[model samples]
Target: MRILLHICCAPCSLTVVRTLQDMGHEVTGLYYNPNIHPVGEYLRRRDTLRQFQEQMGIKVLYKDNEYDPQIYFKEIAFREANRCFHCYRIRLERTLFIAKRGRFDAYTTSLLYSKFQKHDVIADLGRDLAGGGQVGFFYHDFREGWKEGIEQSKAMGMYRQDYCGCLYSDFERRKKLLSE
Candidate 1:
């Protein structure tokens, strides 16, 4: 399968990329995250993924370089409670679009590897986005490699973020820190 994996960040992509490649699938990464707020953090994560791509000799398509937080804020402002679903939809829709254009056999995401993310929502969104499309949704519970990915990333000196790439998630992280 020629898979277009939606890479969230370097740490998350490491395991997913490796796992798919090991399964004999040709994996190309798609970096289309518009939800990562605060320009600096976004750049850091993007650059880290680029570095990883270089190290692994993988082909990665960078969808955007401009940081547009207003777009995200506007979409999720009133729907904050279900913000993740919207976020997943936006990214997955873009991925499926690119997958079709790029002639990929299937699509998947590194988000599925994150325990902090809404796995079911992402899976459903991927399936819906791929419906009636030429590319199929490749489902894999990558959470099993979470720990190994984290440790490998640390060993590789990659930048590992604490939150799920949004202002609200940043606030939630801070709240958890204060409570702990």
Candidate 2:
């Protein structure tokens, strides 16, 4: 099956990509992260992904758009608790739309590989986006390979982000790191 893998970042996608390929699925990396804050950070992640794609010999669908923090902030709007729900909705929705248009058999995301992310929430959003379409959502607990993913990323010299993406999460990461 051909899979449209929504790549959050090169580091997170490292193991996921390899795993998918090992399963004999053709993988195309999609970079559609409007959630990654600050223009510089977004570009950094993009560039890293480009490098990884080249090294892995994978096809890429790059959504070269500027970082729009407002889209995220406005959607979540004071509901700090449910911010991730909206974020997942926006991203997975985009992926599903592309999958429908592109006629891909299935779709998945590197976000699922992150131990820090809300796994169940992401799965819920993915299911909602699919809406019983021909395109199915592939959910794997890639968090099981978290340590190996990080290690492989380090060896590959990928840029590993500290925060989980959104501005609030970035600020929270900074605050937590500072206190520690």
Candidate 3:
């Protein structure tokens, strides 16, 4: 199966890419995260994913690297309490649209790999976006490879970020650290 994998970052994509290839699926990465806050952090993650793609000889499609935090904030501002749900919808909708245009058999995301993310919500969103079987949602519990992915990323000298993207997540991370 040809699959378009939505990559959030290099560390998260490492195992997902490997696993898909091992399972005999052709995977092309799509890097489109407008939700990552601050231009520096966004560039770092995008560059890291590019580095990994080069090293692995994987094909990837990158959206324009325009720093537009306003677009993200605008989408989630009113829905701050359910920001992630809006965030997931924005990204997944785009992924599915791309998958349909690219003629990919299915689409999945590295978001599912993070224990910090709401997996059920993402899965449901993917399913909803993939309605009518125009493209399938390739659901996999990638968190099972979480530890190994971390080790592999470290071995590769990849940049592993501490927070889920976005200013809100960064603030939450700092808050948790202070509390601890």
Per-residue lDDT over 24-103 for candidate 1, one digit per residue giving the tens place of the 0 to 100 score: 99999988888997778888998998887977658999967535777678778889989999888878888898899999
Of candidate 1, the 10-residue stretch with the lowest lDDT total is 63-72
- Candidate 2 has a TM-score of 0.93
Ranking by lDDT: 3, 1, 2
Q: State the lDDT of candidate 2 residue by residue for 47-86, as single tens digits.
A: 9988778787689898876347777777788887888888
Q: What Cα-based lDDT does every candidate model obtain?
A: 0.88, 0.86, 0.89
List candidate 2 segments past 4 Å from native.
176-180
Q: What is the TM-score of each candidate against the true structure?
A: 0.93, 0.93, 0.93
> Candidate 1 at residue 156, lDDT?
99
Model 3, span 1-180: residue lDDT tens: 999999988999988999898999999999888899877899999999887897765799998554477778888987899999988888888889899999999999999998889999999989888987869999999999999999999999999898899998889888967888
Could you tell me the lDDT of residue 52 within candidate 3?
80
Q: Which stretches of candidate 1 lie over 4 Å from their true place?
A: 176-180
Give RMSD (Å) of candidate 1 vs. truth. 1.9
